[model samples]
Target chain A: MESAIPLHLETPRTRHKRVPDDYQPPYPSFVARYKPSVNRVVMAYFGLQYRGTAAAAATDALAEIAARFAAEGGPSHWDRAQYVDQAGYENVVSVAYWDDIARFDKWFASAREAWTGAQPEGIGTFIEVLRPTVARHETLFSSLGRPEGVAAISGGMSGEVQEHAYWGGMRDRIPLSQTGPMSPGGNPELIRDGARLRVKAHDNLCLIRSGQDWSDTETSERKLYLDDVEPVLREGMDFLRDDGLGIGCYANRYMRVLAAGGDASEKSYGQSWWKSLAALERWAESHPSHVRIFGAAMKYLSTLGPSAKLRLYHEVTVAAADEQFFEYLNCHAKTGMLAAVETVAA
Target chain B: MESAIPLHLETPRTRHKRVPDDYQPPYPSFVARYKPSVNRVVMAYFGLQYRGTAAAAATDALAEIAARFAAEGGPSHWDRAQYVDQAGYENVVSVAYWDDIARFDKWFASAREAWTGAQPEGIGTFIEVLRPTVARHETLFSSLGRPEGVAAISGGMSGEVQEHAYWGGMRDRIPLSQTGPMSPGGNPELIRDGARLRVKAHDNLCLIRSGQDWSDTETSERKLYLDDVEPVLREGMDFLRDDGLGIGCYANRYMRVLAAGGDASEKSYGQSWWKSLAALERWAESHPSHVRIFGAAMKYLSTLGPSAKLRLYHEVTVAAADEQFFEYLNCHAKTGMLAAVETVAA
Candidate 1:
């Protein structure tokens, strides 16, 4: 939650990895861009694999939480997913994007009421956080109004820049500001009064991934889905969403791999963002949702015998929210990294 | 939860089904009994099918709850099980038996703190309840002390008349008496001041059955456990527990079927008790858990290409608490049906 040490310090938090020239877009589909007026971006996934009556409770809980978000205008972009896969385990997840870390923090603390309620008892759920910068991360979204993740709050912009791969090579993408001398180079005296974007020393970003697609029926892939996968992924998703909110998660989405690229076709992916590593780990290790879910899994594996198809995976990454450069090209105003292009580049 | 109707009125409740002559002890294992002096008994199972981090969370939650129960001095007997199957799915469950419905009722409410806390975003959770009487119900507990369900509170008794069944021959395990003429052979004067156990007129009992094992995977018994069934099962259980509670369900449990007599080896059952059929039906029909669980099952059936192994079944029974018979043999001092037999009969 607190800054992961300042960017000026020499640590993993400040380490900047230049984007690889061989890096192709992570998605096979066309991707849209969003720009917003914030130094940080947060993405998350809320998903579960379920059956029985509790599935409905999960959905109801999600609907209730969604309603709460809609009322509070919690995230800039919030999207729903029916059935999502976590490794081999089947699940449902929602992807949400937040432009303001402060707003996200505030919402996370006081919004307990949105998640406080009764839900079915056996669904498995967790939150994942992925902190992507313009350089290391790429996304593709449909133009359909169902804008997921960060696309909902972005506006259009275009420009180009040579330096700072972290800025992602948009035409006029620019950085938000913080006090003190900016990184890479000292403040541009010429741009001090100009519209140049700014940067902070210790902006923190996080990446989280967690979900299960198969359970006891995990020994064989075909039988896994045939026996364990829920035919209606949405039912499970709704159950998860309703229950997901009860535990604190900044934002999460259940994603189907329409284009697996090199990955398995049946595999589903989830993306989530959290304020810090501590917050994310605490929920995973100590919370009831995770504890009960994994507990059942261990018991299932022990009772039902070998299950090779069911699997769970996760990755965590943290970085400075704003890097040293920005370039907004054919992007929107609400998108992170280019959200305030005009205000900064001018 | 009020009673369905007054006990004085002639209804199905007042009707007694004499123990059948063909009846036999319900289990292959030897069973002991406890003679608690309470008319109404409450039993439940907390189970989930989960994997990865989520399973741990479920266990943690349960552990926390068990600790709370231990702290609160809950139930006469509370036990734990792992890899228990309910129907076809797999999970771990904690079976609890309460001798006093009044104490159970008190614990259900006002004990919110025990369940309140931060959990992961998506882990389906649910509660189920079932009501059964001596005639229709039977159990066997291992000498290992892992007492479950009704067996947790029952005691042994051997003295019997040729007319009574091992199912306690309580002259009226008869539904607990209301403030009226009692039941079929109403004669309050015979034992006006006897220290007999009593039950509330409207005290409701629920029977919930869920969780799957090899049934959904039975087409290829080898493939059953190979496929992931825990996710959906957990999802399903949570949906039921959450939605069930929202409705009139008093409690529920996810059970592992250790033995099913003549049935296939892999089968688990759930038990949930409800205040009234109407209350249960309302929640089942309109609540999110039932709708979504069934919907998910339908979708799962539709998607997996073949769902022959998957099956869902449940039974419902409503009855008065005290039965029409009671026989006190050599049993412990805490069994239901005759909690204070010595005190009352003396």
Candidate 2:
């Protein structure tokens, strides 16, 4: 609170240039180093228009890319629920990722090019790049291994304020243990089963351990320093998990924080990977208890103060590939005399 | 699926300027005519550092705006949830809608200024914009109030594809007929007691009238086209609602269906928006269901995919204004400035 601690960096401007590995404390404990892992992430959002019969071809190509990525245990990918604008035109958010920029480039070039090449026509990709910065990550509830546990396996998404009230009720309605258990060790298991509960349970097992704010009467409407907020949040997360109620994702005193001026780090925002939409649907359809609690939570949100809000954005994995083929794809695809010669050579 | 319809327009390159409202659809539909009636929604996401104190101020301001809009029977507003980012930071998204663009602009200007002015010393705002084009849009579910019966009113979220699976599964688990009926002229007398059940019921009871996909069969996967896919989606959605499930969201599929390209849209990549960190936190505390769903979704995503392949970005919204505001406040401000300070006749 006191003049807001000067964050480690004014803003996450250059932080995302080289994707970080893991969360680091960025702060020092009582005479010790507490560096949080800083993962570098780069995102390029594209708006494209293609020729006839290309949309399906492109999407299928993307799906293939995703399937391949899944097989390789790579960054997840998928097609957002398809949507259209007023002109009867359709579009999507092509999403892809990479731990290493070089690898990403490889995937971008090779796999992406192959997919595009298969298209009946060319695509008009967005001119401007799209990226955002991220900070203070937390995982609230998760489970794995069960039919309903798939939801828990994936990481939580960047939240919108409008939906908070609904989730608030949900936290109260569902007992944590029922959803899943807390991870006693550092490495929580991933969901191999069909359900999201398996993942949810494991996620609950792993406490936020950092970054959080608790809901206490005294702290109501009060500003908290990250130092103050983190410990309290950690304790509360542990308590929730210990009590068998899933840990929650919350930032007390919503609406009062700000990013360091001039900060520009590419952040992550969007849906996660699923074996298929079918896989996701099955988990939801079969899980009645989870659904009940989830419903009650939503109803409660509607009754809360007008402090929440909602926004939806779709991300489609327009192009993607693995490390091996990128070089020959994006980097080597040249137009002109050389391209002509290469085509003839092929 | 016979050579799908050509949905994209080959506009001149110069016209590709992506103005704020540049995404206007050339065609006409409910979204074109009725979108204005329904509030224009925005979801703002912020990182953890910003969520400390600055975010709260911004969220408070947003809540005030949402209330004002709701008072006018305008569109709804709220912040959905906080998500864990690869960059090792926590991010929150806020959702809000306004009746008229003018009102929204007024609120946005006021909020923006207030946010900047009240920004914590070190913390700044990181924001991004994600507007769905035809190629990438997801409107999986939609529900309306039955005549007078209200089946249910729940709070839910739809994450970007990169984060995790869909968050709507929460809705699937709720009991059917929890509230009264649908809307626009159904049986309003069913749950007249104003009890939770009565309130839960939809007014015009058009439960899941339609969806994007019909069945989850592999066979359906083969015919993935607007023409081929639309019918199944419609049927599936109808079944959900008619079978007691609520409608998701009336999607703008026409554009997506039209743009039959090999890939999806550009908005699929990383994108976010939020005033301050604190504001994001308040939203999280208030909305726990989102936390649970988001957390579960994220964890599930971690194992199913490779963390190394992902990329994230964070951006800040310095001066965001809509068209109505450009005409109202901006123009008026300029006019006022030009007003002849006329030699005060001094």
Candidate 3:
């Protein structure tokens, strides 16, 4: 594995996170581990939107979809929750994870046919899916718990990793980033026919899901979070949502993770799309918004020390154009990847 | 106003929306008309966030700020609303409009001194302001009532505008876009000292605040919106928030407008930041998410005919680097323009 390149060689740009020779992380963090045989994973979001009057119909639709997933040849792991969207519409979203794209492909065919075949009136249904290779994905968690998102399908969590608790740590965690800078290539293109729209993604399109869980915090810690930290976090999220183009963020959503009964839970997360891993890294490392977030988080963690019950985690993926699939049926023009690409008549 | 350029001349790219010579709008839409003497205006968002326990403190703070505005030198008009942010924290936001920046400057000095001097414990405060020249701003409305945002500072609504019901109409509506392609010219730079961070913005950074109001909708129209249009709109907004990089959107927020008592009102909006007007136009003209939004709106409007009560409006501004100012005090790293630029030690 030895290379001819010298250790002292300095390139104009570095592909990996640079820390001072004596730099050490303030706290230990863990990275999700996957089996060597697992090369690609599929993350799919099945969303169903309904009005209050159509609750029964929406429930029936969701039940049918759940039944299919429970049948043979389904995803390896799946979770569902209910929430109210920004427009105050009731929505039930099911997230499914599959370690093997082939198995997902097999299950998706039947699921798509059954779901699209029966179009329930007064309900909005959509499927947004992504398949990223192992090298293109990265994950970090502050503490161990039942892993969420892509981690649910992972083999286990790694012991404390050395790459975290500092700027550029996220990029340094991504395996692909070690070999080359994941720069975006080409542009997203959309094909439309009638009510259906499909968006073809571009190379190195980056997606990040940064989450927080104060559901298990003590009363004092909860107050500290609600009073001191959460407001700062919301400010950052709002900034990203309203004015985040100059630094390379495309879109951002600060979503409340809802309970099964559709009540706002103690958990929430920010989902964002970036032009490339570099753009995201730039913002995280140097943007004032991120700096403020880091400062507040550090202060909070230090104040509570080991007794801090609040949990934080994130997953970032840079998907190749061919690895992404975005389609909408009877959905709005701004759904998912549709807003990032040009649409043309099929 | 006559120029050497011929009418039939076709440039490499067009700065305005293009429609067939015989094209007629499906429905009439109006643009806000500013007084001839008014060449610029300032929009400021004064926000106060507090926990439930600090409601009284927040109220007092709001009263103090409002009192200042009501005094001798102040904004031309102002409106207030209370809403819950994504983090479940209560926020009271006051939007003030000033036709003159110098007048705002005069008021802001005292306001800043008074507001910042008193750091009310347990309450988080911030100010986000934008000043754009008349040529750099544009506004449109399906039907006007008490106009919101920048329109609140305008003279009145124009008669049925020619640019409506067509792709690229937004660009055509912008007075500056008629002459020049509003492209970004520089990168955002930041300077930080302790808890304070200041961001210098780039040229032609586009800002859009697109709003929807169904507050006065009849039962049937309200149902039509909730059942059909709203879901689609949420999908589009979510798309922009979660995945809007490839088409040039930097950030997008789908926010619910709240009542005076912090209850959700029958109004919402999508506020987004884009790299340039051209990028925005491209998305509006051909992106699937926007296409779906336009389709749904047209269907709703046509279905309800002239009796439709759902109101829609948007304001777009392409600000020069010097025209924009971003500053944060004891704020998180990801606040406002902070997320869109680099931060350096002051």
Candidate 4:
């Protein structure tokens, strides 16, 4: 659920505020901190609410059944949390992740039955149902706050700082960067040396990108182009990484493969946490090696196809971090909140 | 991606799969192990390939710009992953996470201009035109391998000692416990005192009861009937925690509220993870407390005017430990995964 709340004031500020006669707010409970093991599995749940009193009944029944099942012999080694709201109106998105697909599959089937069975008459009213979509990727970098000495840097080399100027403006902050090609000048200096952790998961991206045809393969000539594509593709990826451009740094170069049907369906995304936006922006604006490699890669791709049907998006994550990063990992599962600090400050 | 991969190949097989000479296999160097962090944000790109050469060109340009931008100082921190096949086609899903949103946001803006500005004329020729949708949600939970003990208990759970089970009969090696309700006596001995991670995440349930109603308020006449509700809800939650019937023993709940007008239309979701289908189940079978609470909740909700809307969902999680959990967490921004280890090295 997107967050917002109106806490009771010691003094009433708004005249329209109306407190329910029996309103009893749940007390704030302190959550315990716990470090997660590396082999853990996490799940997020997204749900769409049914309209009317029936929807309430549906949710309550679901809650009861779930609680009972847990008491019976369900796994208790993980954390669980939820959010409900009427804010989004007709659309209600419920998302939850599981430690493993196997266990998740079991929980999924049983839960479906319980929910449907509970409201024999009202369960079929859901609109816009979507199947599960999964994507896996790796983390290359992260930045949670402005790094030291960024302001002292000259030009736009402030890396993520520049990126933020553009993206934040789009999100209703302030307009600084215009919507167009970025002029080269400002570029943040890369850490000449530092300990950067790199992690990779199995087939997350490949599985999602499989079967997307950027070039027409319906003809033999188009298919032959594939032969020369491998080396170029590798070079391009290598350049992207070696240059430290980070993913999604470009506005118009977005690429997506069409789903099996002729529609363009894509996979989920990976998370990031750079040390600073200035650092991020510098990589985006001034990387020279990436410029050359990516350009060559594009030229090669154009040989098989033309430029159409493509779109691009740009976002600046001024402050960034993995949702399941160390700080997140230490949060209490039950409350969807941070736990009391033992090793780190809350 | 709903899982369809077979689980029979537990032991690694020879890596001898052949690919067409023209096949552009993704670079293996791009793959890495996953790390868990609490503060990470991902910037992902989804491109539709069906848009043809023009789309490819636009995407190429964006890629080039992104690469060049990286050269500036973005800290090479992006991973291009997930190419999903909807129907029979494919689409690309690239992701990168950051430690801070501000830094990412800055780079994101500049990149946006580069991408949008580079679009070729008549770009719509390659594919259908649809604005891409970007969504952000917090991480919840994740797991790997049969949630804690499902793997160990696979022997009794599966006479043939199969590993995993798919939903219904769709996939191979999946188990029923992970799929649906287990028979009361399925594994009495295995239902020990400690937490047993299951094969699934959330459990969705319906609260069933005879008779129904349309009430406007909890009038004085029904005060006694309402008096018994709170106990039931507490009982259910307590039972799940104490008795160990639910998956991922930890539990939490949230409430959802709509923000009056157009703002509500932009984003949608229910409160907490309970909004999903799986968590709802735990609330049901966990205990009698849930049943009582549900009855009360329904009655109370029914009094929120004739038009009050309510929905239900339940979920249970099976978490993993160590590398497995870390893999799960690093994969998503909002979800947290705890590893599943040998609770007792029996």
lDDT of each: 0.38, 0.25, 0.70, 0.25
| lDDT per residue (tens digit) for residues A146-220 in model 3 | 587788889788776766654456666676655566778876777765566666667998988888989999889
Model 4: residues with Cα > 4 Å off, grouped in runs: A1-233, A236-273, A297-316, A320-346, B1-346
**Model 2: per-residue lDDT, tens digit, B186-305?**
211212221111111112212111112212223323233223433433333233222211112211111111112322321111121112112222222223333443334333324333
**Which model scores highest in TM-score?**
3
Backbone clashes in candidate 1 total 200
The ten-residue window of minimal lDDT in model 3 chain B covers B1-10
Candidate 4 chain A TM is: 0.25
**What is the alpha-carbon lDDT for the whole of candidate 3?**
0.70
Docking class of 1: incorrect
TM-score-better candidate, 1 vs 4: 1
Which candidate leads in DockQ?
A: 2
Better of 2 and 4 by TM-score: 2
lDDT of 4 at A312: 18
* lDDT per residue (tens digit) for residues A188-279 in model 2: 22222221111111111111111111222123222332233333333432332222111121111101111223122112121222222222
Better of 2 and 3 by DockQ: 2
Give the DockQ (C-alpha) for candidate 3: 0.01
